[model samples]
Target: MSAPDPLHDLGVRADADGGLLRLWSEHATAVELVVFAADDLDWAIDRVAAERDEHGVWRARSARLVPGAHYGVRVDGPAGPAHAFNPVHTLLDPYATGLARADDGSWRGVALAPLDAPADRVYEAAARPPAPRIPLDRTVVYEAHVRGFSRRNPAVPAELRGTYAGLAHDASIEHLTRLGVTTVELLPVHAFVSEERLVRQGRPNYWGYNTLAFFAPHAPYATTDAQAAGPAAVRDEFAAMVDGLHRAGLEVVLDVVYNHTAEEGRHGPTFSFRGIDNAGYYRHGVDGEYFDTTGCGNTLDFGGEPARRLVLDSMRYWAGEVGVDGFRLDLAATLGRDEDGGFDAEHPLLRAMLDDPVIGATKLIAEPWDVGPGGWQTGNFPAGFTEWNDRYRDRMRDFWLSDLRRERETGSAGSGIGRFATRLAGSANTFAQERGPLASLNFITAHDGFTLADLTAYDVKHNEGNGEDNRDGTDANRSYNHGVEGRTDDPEILAARRRSIRNLLGTLLLSAGVPMLTAGDEVGRSQAGNNNAYCHDSELTWLDWSWGEDARRLLATARHLIRLRAENPALRPVRYGVFGETTPSATQMDWYNADGATMTIDDWNSPAERTLQYLAASTPETEGPNRILLVVHAHEAPTEVVLPAHDGVDRYVLLWDSAAESPDADDAPGAPASETRPAESRPGERVGVAAQSMRLYRAEGAR
Candidate 1:
């Protein structure tokens, strides 16, 4: 009907003999494919002229373009305000499946032959099985770095430590399986390079956000053998890791960075996108200045079809070929911005990702914001995508940490439990009713901020090591140090911090939304007050396997809380409850004050009234009918709460308590499921809630 899109198959594709190469550049007057010697990348063996089609795609084919051959493209184009095309500059193919560094310090793309049988196929043939496809409601995500996760693990082999294989190691799988997280959201594994500035400063971009190539896995993260074996081997290792995790019933979710590129500012680098089509690949002002929304130098121009297709292709490769279960998009708001740079809910790229058959079926979670204007789009993503709820993080922290600090310093907490309760029951005011609670990926602490332990132990961020002279990280951490900052020998302070950790973990795992736990938070890992530890690949950022007494206790408590959440269907509602009607999979919640009486509007807003009781009953759809009562006290001062009397409930069994030093006995880390059964109490029974703690009770009713 119409001219076929030249962007289709825009990379090297193997045929029966040689290979076909396609390159896209609207401004390029001439394009040439340069093949390098296999042994010496710096030496060019041949240059083949490429013929341009009507769709601006330049095509060429050569027997030398077979697998393992190194190549790059040279484009001749008109230079102007928005364009940075250079005829002499050697550029990488945007869709390069593999990349390599030459001895001369330049980069080239390695041609990969189409797999006769995909590695995932071979993996399947081995009967490794596939992902469990854990339901969204039942998914508990554990966010970790592939390298940092196993770097310090004692059980992982020395050579395998800090590699993709390390994560697939039996010990690592066992640890994750034992921890009870259904999904593992790994930080970026895309091919990335340290920022020019970070490299010059003798530091590296530890988080791998500076993506160089979207389709390729970071080769350095693979084992030495894989790295020596080449890109295809690296990819095989990555696939094997996914297969291993899948066999363990763990879903692997990649944290992808499509918003920006490693080719930073105009003067930064002449890599793939920049040298190929700078203006078309990056968002820029009228004067050719970059419109940097990602705060990472250059933002990818999602407004262009080529750029959008690049992301879609990358996603399809990972989801289909690699067998990952999901993706957590970094700086996702940038992907939704239109040509005019305004945030649009129905941007073509966003819609395409949600509608694409392969990617749409997988879980898509958005970080939902960038550093640009109108950046805070927490609940603004479309129906199919779940967004990281920063509002929930702030409110929970404020009520538990900052509010408690205010009470100690100003004689009154700054806010009531109203906002906290909204998040607890699911932020109906934020997310659309159709999207429901699952749309909210609720977490109090993420990789970018303080750990759960730091949230209770640090009043200020200590980010001097980031080379920004303590000016880097966000000042508004919303954290309190519990009378002393950093490490403290004070028993009272230590006990208070432990209680705060329990409360935070309890709230997150018990909340009515998808929960994401930062990897080492369960073990009380701290960045030593450094909220922004993105530059540190050392022990500071790695998850330490060695656990102290407090860390062990906290880990056990976390496991117990996660288990409790799985057992109680009322805690995880699929939909928001209507005020006067029963909705399937929705939780009908009733609010009460310390006196067990219904809460008044005044009580909800009063700063002095910091204690409240919540009773939730689940309208069963797939699970049995369930009811639970949660008591929340937000002040340092102890309070007595009267358990609310519900129509169908007769007695309440104590399920979990945050005030307990350990979840079980002092000697035992986690209490057995049977031992967690405390004495049952009748309605109106008074229970002493310790300072700044939460308690959960399962309501048993007379049938």
Candidate 2:
């Protein structure tokens, strides 16, 4: 009745007797399966002609398609501008679960036995731990890389460092669990290759944004044992990493690049999709020139059935078979673009992905923008998706860094606290009401930008090592140097920078939306002012675990702040409160000025009024009823402020303060961060808040 779905069973399906390989190609005249000898990859052992079925899907069967068989396809078609068929250039299967490079630098697909088995059997409940299934509100995402996370760590064994297995090591688990983050968001683990330009310059794509295959785990991330054992073993190692994190009550979210492949521009190499059906798989112009939108070459034509199905199928395999908890779609705006290359919130592919049964349960984070025309769809994604809120990032940075720099030069902060207050309360203007605050994945620093320490130490990007004549990387750093660029020995400047770092960290964790911390920010990791270090695989990008007392203090402060957020449900509201109606899981907010009076228009908009107190009380649903008070002073001058007097609130107990150098000495992992004894005060009592500092308190209820 329905012309049997053409993309179904589109990859190798094997058994003991033989195997069947099916591939979809609209323009190809013939398809031949080429099986190579296991010992010698260049030696072809069997060649079978494939039969083209009615739906344009070509099918071929052979006993050689069994597990561990090295194979490829040679497609032949008439020469045309819209066609690129080379029967001699054996192309990889678009749905390959494993890949291997040949002697001549060409690519071939490898058949793995586990791929044909039932998904449940491959990842049994006992062998593979269950997903943490952490709710959006409780999620604290620590964005780290597989290699950079453990490469320089002394705790990890020498041989296992920089491998997937290393991330599952006891040391790694202890570090993550102690940090209080619920999720570990990793950089792309999908199989990728360096860009053609980076390759020529003898540099590596350390960030792994350039993907070659969506289904295959990047084999290089596996330890020597896994790699030597073969592709299936490599995947099992990845699974073990996930299992370890899950056992520690941590979830894993992968950064996926389905927007573009490693195949660069029109003149680039003929890899899997480009060689299979160039015009059908990628967006192209009239004369076959690629419609490059992802900036790293051609964009996948998500409008087409086969191309869309490719991404969906890959996601299903990873989520169901591999047991990954979630995915963060890199440059995801391209996925929402239609046939005409226009971004649509209601794109068929986007809707389908949100509704898919397997992946729907998993967290789907969208980078939410691309380098294409009309590609900045930050707040316009579908309801089910959570987006990287760039507005929130820029606003927070401007308030804490750029605006501070402006104040020092112009004697006045350029903007008021209105915007900053909005972001701190959950960016209701950016995301929809139905989606609530959880729709925004808030982060000031990501893998693509400068490290947290660099933001306080560097005034501009230092990317001279990238071989792009320093022309690469973004120029809008929104960073401050505190009277010195790079590192400084000035005690005053150093103290100021440390306080600023704490302020940024405090704002990020205490903010209403879900927070994502870059890997080594807790220990004050710096990149030597290099804002974009994507091309560097050296120690420059690897996180150095060796740090002195300052870093240790910073880590303690981060842990304390994270614990406070976990205990105070008012700080992590799931919904926005209505005017008078109390919404469950929402926070009822009250704003006050320096005089402890209700905030008026002038107090909210005037740059001169830099101090304000925020009182948030949770309309409890899952957690207990909670209330907290947060005082913020933006100017670099000590000020005395009266605490707000609210109904049911009698006194305030201090939780954390950015004014302090760091957390107390005993505020370590097992330490109780009790009120610094003398810090508690009654409502309406004036308290001294240090310059450019913030204070958090638990509002002790009288009722």
Candidate 3:
């Protein structure tokens, strides 16, 4: 038996003699660097045994360790599940800047870590594309999966389909630009490994929240040629993609999952973090067992310096090297946990990110909770950080799904318009005034749950496609199908579905806080009622770009709504302050209902009342005082609500109507709805909104 090497002790040096790359396998008695020929697929021309340093790091300096060379590490040591020290197995190099895939569907480490693949190849650092960095106040995030986004685009090149290049193509860029989203927050792009269990079941981990290497972009997304060229090529392709997207004027934000690793349970793979320093990297029980904070098997001990550094370094790498504009930290509360294994709002990692100059301007959004104690941190994050407002999701769901359903079934709408109004005004009670309304990243549908279509098409989740029966996802989903579940050719039901979707999208775009629209929602993408379609890497989950008339209408409506939000700064108020013009604006909101009267507390509690009206007047504050009136009626029977003319405002104009096939041009700022005063609710003209619809009117001559 030979002595083990201190893996971390070895140092890498680059000079005229090619470049030196090393992996420290402290417990491994022997380490071999397997270098593959750059032009050949099936051969490695060189094998050099790595010498060990006192700290147990394996080191080797050779002309063969050049930048373009592909390589892997084979380590021999005490064998274990958490520590698979195999001598014969060619392991992917942890520090390999480039990687490739073998015939066996496994990643092959690239020895030459740069795209050019030469000893003298100058390594260019990753850079941010020249995209506009939209302010937090104006951001409307579109959460999308990279592959799914491009897979169905016919305009994209066949060879580039489902690749980073495809996403960067003019077709994809044009779609986004037309959609009017300033930022595209992609699902995890970091390197991820499919769960062995799922692989055996013939499904891949498509959502990619399960990260294998935080520093590496997922290789599968690169072009086939790039993948063949190895990790460096893959990286270059990704960088080029971001640069292309930036040039198109859209910012790229990442959905980063740092709370846990792909190293699942205690029997997971020996990836970099686990093998490098198990005890120092992961949170453990009293007897040195794993503590699962993320419910993803093992949690990173962010309290430990090594684990903290890993996260911080990864963030810096993506922001600085990868040119990402911002990050939405998955289970962010876990990163703020203290040494005692409890969450701390002032954790060093949080403080450091807040203070880091390079990443300071980048948007920092928190998922805000974990599976650990006190995990639901909602508004608990420090100021300057925005959080995904789950409360907003629930309330909106209630308004359009539950409350709407309750209104139809029981002939009454429970809950006050005030609650919905609060969320619309950015939930002042939940988020602080200093943090402003933008602190709430309001969303109705996300990657984890039902699509906007399914939210109104299915009452319960159908996750059978996930291969987990139906028990895997959240059962407390607050969704509602107007009359029938799943798909139906019934015209009436179909019309209702469209109306519900319009309602949800309208609320999301018009809400006071920042809005995040899940991709495919605007295009009527459905997962066949499967809310948890995380594993289906097929068309069932991808956006069907082949335009249907209804889908096109929805897309157009969404675009107009987004443009409205961008043009009307008053819609995105930073704060709902005192009812005046200076400093604190966005406070001039008036509430009314059918019969044209201010809503009283009794009106809110009355279930019989299913109609309401709202007029938002933005004062001449930093944002604005643009005024618009919205009327909503959720009734099975057609009812006309009297138009409430404001005190100093006369002649209401029509700007938009959900029931209309398209937005009325007269619905623009100058040309409002009808000025006929809604005909005084004449003989059943109660301001007739169909069974379920919303209408908006812009009025002039403010009081």
Candidate 2 residue-wise lDDT, 1-703, digit = tens: 6766667988998976778899999888889999999878788998999999887899999988887788999998878777788888989888888888889888788887663355533335455667889989989999999999999889999878999989999998899889899999999999999988888999999999999888789999999988887787788788878888888889999999999999888888888787788878989888988888888878899988888999899899888877888899999999998878899999988898889999888999999999899989888998888899999889988898998999999999888889999999999999989889999999999998889899999989999999988898899989998999988799999999998999999999999999999999999999998888999998998888898999988998998899988989999998888888879899999999988999999888898887889999996777778999999999988999999899999999888888776667543122343543535689989988889989998898874
* Shift in Å, residue 558, candidate 3: 0.9
lDDT by residue for model 1 over 1-703, one digit each (tens)?
Answer: 9977568888998776677899888778888999999788888888889999887889988888888789999988888888888878788887888889888677899987443354443233244466788999999999999999999999999999999999999999998988899999999999999998999999989999999898889999999988998887888788889888998999999999999999998788878888887878899988988999999888999888988999999999889877899999999999999999989999999999999999998999999999999998999999999899999999988888898889889988878878888999889989999999999999999889899999999999999899999998899999999998899899989998888888999999999999999999999999999999999999999999998888887888888888889989899999999999888889999999999999999998887888989999996678888899998988877889899989989998878888886677643323465754475788999978888888888999984
Model 2 segments more than 4 A misplaced: 1-3, 115-126, 666-678
lDDT of 3: 0.76
Query: Candidate 3 at residue 573, lDDT?
Result: 73
TM-scores for all candidates: the values are 0.97, 0.97, 0.87
lDDT measured at residue 87 in model 2 versus the true structure, 0 to 100: 84
Taken over the whole model, the C-alpha lDDT of each candidate is: 0.89, 0.88, 0.76
lDDT, candidate 3, at 194: 83
Candidate 1, residue 46: lDDT? 81
Off by over 4 Å in 1: 1-4, 114-128, 666-673
Greater-lDDT candidate between 2 and 3: 2
Of candidate 1, the 10-residue stretch with the lowest lDDT total is: 116-125
As a whole number from 0 to 100, the lDDT of residue 486 in candidate 2 is 88
